[model samples]
Target: MPSSSASPPPPPWLQPPFLLPGFKPELEPKIEPMNCPSGQLEPFVTRDTLLFTPPNPNTVPDEVENAFPEHLRLAHHLGASSNDHRSVISAPVVEVPAGPSDIVGSRKRKARSAEMVRASIVDTPDRLYFRGLVRRTRMTYDSLRYLLLTDDHGRGEAGLSDEITRRRKARSDLTAGALMGNRDLWLNRDSRIIGCIPGIRVGDVFFYRMELVVIGLHGLIQAGIDFVTAGRSTSGEPIATSIVVSGGYEDDDDKGAVLIYTGQGGRERNVAQQRSDQKLHGGNLALERSMNYGIEIRVIRGIKCNKSPSGMVYFYDGLYKITDCWMDLGKSGFKVYKYKLLRIKDQDEMGSEMFKLANELKQNPSGGRSVGHICLDISTGKENVPVSLFNDVDNDKDPLCFEYIAHSIFPQQTSQGAGSMGNGCDCTMNCSMGCYCALKNGGCFPYDENGTLLRGKPLIYECGTGCKCPLTCPNRVSQKGISYELEVFRSIETGWGVRSFDVIRAGTFVCEFSGITVTKQEAEQLSDDGCLVYPGKFPARWIEWGDISDASPDYVPAGFPSTPDLSFSIDVSRARNVGCYLSHCRSPNVFAQFVLFDHMPYPRVMIFAMENIPPLRELSIDYGVGDGYA
Candidate 1:
């Protein structure tokens, strides 16, 4: 999946060390300089190879933002503001939409880019479309800054231009705003729209405001308001199209159904630092016109969400007609314009409100979401957050008796055994690709700050307790206990299954398969009786996520395995956690991954959300061949 050619023969779980002729197991071909990023082609790993790659070690964290500049505006997943900017040999297909008009790119490229952008927002299913959009946006942005801080190379800060360093000089909401703006990926840009966007549903959450920009939702990245000038409006008056209510203006009030929204402008960008009289211009004027014309403007509300990489999330709360508008004196003593936006009835429940309800459910366990909840916290005090046991289907008091444990229990013979593998990093805070730990993961960190797996790998090496990096380090994702609100609930079909009240974003860490580690022989004996969890049997979707072969055809896609090399399996019958209750399906939304923090011969079984999952949906995983109960 990584640039395996430049590196040593990757661990067995990865692609074959030698090139394949027609991907044959035999008949190794001679070397050739191909157009691949790795200078060799790649193919998906064979499913069986999962059984051979022992102690897979690519779970390291990405860029160390704590040790570098804080203002990286692009996607912040793997290395939030990744410095590992190794340039791709082939230039990225440059079909950005808002580049200099004077330089018209190829028409074919433009058409392809526009079509993909439109399809991403208007045609496909919400889960698939958003996942591809968000993933591609991050990958594109990461590539743009290629040749920045490399994994094995020296820090390349001195090589970056001022514009790249300053991150386009905007607020945090505008992460990757420039590329999406200048790139030719957008369509519906004529403005003057007054209704809901195609494909976008009410309560849909976005991690960045720039995502709102790319999908033709709200165009203004930094500005709170988006409007059509008087010349463009049908009524010959400035009119508003959409507005993002993110508490930029203190006068704004978000009441779920009724929003007492504040009109942008009047004060300096600095918080309460300067004051100015409101003007009847730009978005301010547009809001007034929209209110008078009874125009329903799209409203996306954003709030600080630590679960997101950008530390924020924007929820599309559907359309709201501007019912009232007026000039009002502001808290800073300057006259400001305000508008009352009334949510149109019969739309989906507001996403922000749902988020609020989910938070409440987490805090109100004893009494709620507690009516069916059997145990407020089945984990007792083991997990960082409690895992509730709820059974409304049948009167099951709790899951089969088992001791609650956080970390997987490894056999004495299988443990890394004492001396460190030197798998940790020296980073004081955020672990970067340059850290020794990252090198173990094929010269790249495996995750972003939010603990989202940037790319699926055979193994992910996290910053363990041996590392100087603090516990807050992003690399220590799997080590951290479950962070979401989960419940082990009984179902009519699946019996005991797991679900989440929180909207789990794609690639976010879910939980680990905590159990007593057993040898292969012991696992075989328990397989027929159930409760034997085999890490190698889970689907290896790394190729779908993005392998080096996607960039060029030089390398072959070999070793795309459904299984990974392993010496042990988990015996979850007598002792297990939430992961044991998860079900298996053909269209599963979750996947199992191999992770290690101590650089041991064995990796932990960490579960990650493979797609964006809405609240209360039963979580499922693919059992290699087809759908089956876990």
Candidate 2:
């Protein structure tokens, strides 16, 4: 009872701990709104407060609506008042079903995804470097995604589709549509063909072309350019008919896109300075060479049964033509030459032909790298002979060694009969008229002070062994082996050829043609059996006594049918020297001149350049035959 006034409740600020101590009630009454005449009312209790309006369950999707069965089920068993139940019943329920538009939207999303995948496949980087981008900032993954995932990419796709249609029309316009229609050329049971280019999607064997055959395998293959340097035709004739290079270096195949190389030089570059300098020279030179030469290259790919010790192995893929090429920054930010090639229609033919040739040459793949005589490297003074392959089958089978018969040659022989040997020359200095060999003809040496021939002339007989002059006599030239730096290399078209690293002037003495001295009869027999043989010039007396025509074949024995009226011939089918490699050409840079030095009954064949031969030029001779046959 005390404190009836409650001690005048402590002032609001100084009340008890509950009121004055800096404490407030944990729960507070929320203000309720009510309708009054003034349109607003303060906290007031009302029946509506206990019966609030609930959200309509039907507004949500079925999936979301199904997730709340407990909330919806409460309406059926509610213990609420009648008014509240009626309030719940008053709410409206709407059911909306998904329509065709929804289905179409979902399909559209899927189609976009598919298009994105296709674009990725088309633009996939061959080799991954950083990832998601090419060497330059020309394109990027985000941009690709935006373009491919939206109508923007679809516009491009439409353009491409139109282009595809155009290409298809072009293909239809081809010869009977049979050229590009045939897939049997490169396709086999093991691989499934796809797209215009069969192997671009899948790894396929390609015949890569390069400047150096030995190094091309690595460079072009690594760069994914399928091509192999083409050589001359089998007869050692230049392949001038087609702009395309079908196989390994064809004779005189150093033209056009044919010479385009990514690198400045080739594998044979030994000088450190030159190699270093080549690092910066863009493939511009190669590109220029290719364009100027109008060269076309053929690349092959196909599967074949390999009969090596390794069992059945697939060969190259189909053929492709280098259509276009240009320079671009590589993945490493360096200049890289890129080529765009198109598959050829005759891919099947090329594939089959290459396979057959490969099978034939499988036995001795290195060609002459390890056979016959030592491969003399002109770049390096090295004698590399494959001694292991040598045999004592023939005593005279000295492939590397040959005797230089030194005999006197006279233009007019009054005493000696045909092919009669002349006495030695007693020239203390250059051969003068006093020397018997020099009396009938000028000095046999054709080379001037610059080692180039001064002029072309008939057979100039040099002082031979009969001459008392030293081996250093100016009259002696053919007796010496190859004077200039020479390299014997295997040509894809021809079997082998002699090439030089430096340019050789006209009239330069290349090499002496020597082989097993076979009689004209023996040569014919060998030729009948598909062997290589060259006609030897006539004897000095025969030249003097008889009128010989360049068109006439060598003289054959009476028993044998009359062949070309050649005096003698050399058969090098079995044993030969560098001269055996000199190929034939219509407009040959070199010509054969008859020279007599020793007492040998037959005249020596000396090869001299008829024109200024550039570096890497393959010396050739006109065999007096037409183009078809070498």
Candidate 3:
């Protein structure tokens, strides 16, 4: 806590958040602060005036204050000052409160009722073992959904009239989610509890509603609430398990740690205007009972994300106790029930809160990130999005002077002229499976309508310069250059690493791994130098990420594309882009994809996000864990 020096308060965004006693600051992510040219960091300070700080209640909307009033004000006053930012090590799984009660003087409590042990599932070995499986399942469903949307996006385009539309009326999200659910590919269906789901993290993100169903986060596909019926609850009363605050029913409030959630029904979504009085029969009653019982409920907030292929990102923001619930008159003449849910203490930072800050930074990098910006665009206008260079750790002005190159420089012999290409896709809009390039690439277009790579293959064929398809075609994602903002910052453990100013969604194309291409023999000789990137050594994480064959024994799935043999490696020792600076991790948030367009026979390594990545988290790839930095 800062000394009361009677100094003025910082701006709303810079206000410090209240720190829970045992939060263990060491759990925050370690970001190497760029030395402020003065050769040192701003001396730990009042915790309020840092460059990119944590969430401030003062910065949130009016609804949060209106709903959670007194407590929110207390949270703002208790705003914690931060020191270390260590995100690698997560704190313990949040502990749910002991026996809450639908009836305060129930005989069950007098007779010694059992404490909530179902949440202990989060700490069990079974949960640990299935954690990786859960991740794989979620990503697989998303990738399949994206692939389906590719075929379904162009409904009335010119081409074969006989071409069959796969999912015209039904959305791709529903189809992909349904396929995964029917196969029993998901876990935890037999039992649903009042606390955390096994293997799901607080900040983990989902792109589709069906994804929520498959992963057992939220059971219902469309309804806002997922709860246990009257007979199932310990008290013979319905109990709420989870609720999604989707800004649906404009009455709900989402201010990160504190949420003012609206009960389901009786209103126009987004408009907040009520159609009829909301009833307390099903989910609404469950929520009220849960509040009286003191049970914690999972809160997944859905925010619109332009970076997401599905145009929405569902963020799991830990558990929240329904502290209060009551009926209130809505803006429309009808009555509505609103629940006041407070986020449990000591969990991870809400990804949605961080997302808003990241968006602000992207909109005005100069204004939001007002300090420690070493070089604005390290690429010097070479790429579409600017790559920022920063070093706030020490006076060390590093990443030792290397020439910034946008595209890989291959030997003249490997290059092929555009007119020399043997083929290209002719379809103008969304390239159908019947297109020439689609067929040449084995069958389907490898990307979704939003330009997210559906799956990585031995070789992903894109419309080359000779192709009749426009540059904005869905298949032409990699060639667009870096779509989002990246920063080269110095870290304590890993000297120099790359991160993003934007919250990168899973499967979005990041950048191409570019450098001077070298022959196999040359790569072997320079390998000892410890800078050569052997594409052959890259793992099949992409294939594994898209693997859903284990959904059932009877589900004979289409085979994953084989890993292509590579005779060359990229020499990124000198000239490189943001991709070269990506650190190595066994479990990385990004993966390498093999793509060939202008380079036809030869493929360029394209980097893509593996999951919903929050801003300022160091970007990593599944390559050799060497020298810490890439």
In terms of lDDT, which candidate is strongest? 3
TM-score of each: 0.62, 0.32, 0.70
Q: What is the lDDT of residue 246 in candidate 1?
A: 71
* CA-lDDT, candidates in order: 0.56, 0.31, 0.61
lDDT per residue for candidate 3 within 1-630, as digits (tens), equals 112233234223222232111111111110111111133221222233221233442222111111111111111111111221111112222111222222122111011011123545534455544555566776767655554455443312222112113332335565555444333344455455458766677877676666777677776555567665543333334556788777756576777788887776664423346688877655777787667666788988888766554567788888899888888887676887888999999998886876777677677666565566688788999999888888777776655488899889887776575654566667777576678776655566667677776655666767788788788887788888987789888888877889897777788888988888888877666745766878888876766644444432332233433445577888888898889988887557899888777763457899988876777678888785453231
lDDT of 3: 0.61
Tens-digit lDDT string for candidate 2 (466-503): 66777666557666546555555555555456655334
Q: What is the C-alpha lDDT profile of model 1 across 1-630, one tens digit per residue? A: 112123234222223233211111111111111111223232111222121122213210011100111222232222112111221111233222222232233221211111111122443365444444444544333322232212323222222333334443333223333333333433244322357655456776676545665556775444566664433332334456777777656677777898997665555423542267766555666676567556678888777776655566778888888888788887777787778889999998888887777777777855445356578788897888888888777777657478877788987764462244564566886776578876666655666545556556676667776788788887788888888889888899888889887888777789988888887877766644776767777777544442322222232332322233576788877788988888877546788888776635677888887655656668987767654642
lDDT, candidate 3, residue 429? 72
Lowest lDDT block of 10, candidate 3: 106-115
lDDT score for residue 86 of model 1: 24
lDDT of 1 at 59: 14
Runs of candidate 3 exceeding 4 Å displacement: 1-129, 152-169, 264-271, 275-281, 305-311, 326-336, 418-436, 448-450, 465-470, 491-495, 503-505, 545-564, 599-602, 612-617, 624-630
> Considering every candidate listed, which one attains the maximal TM-score?
3
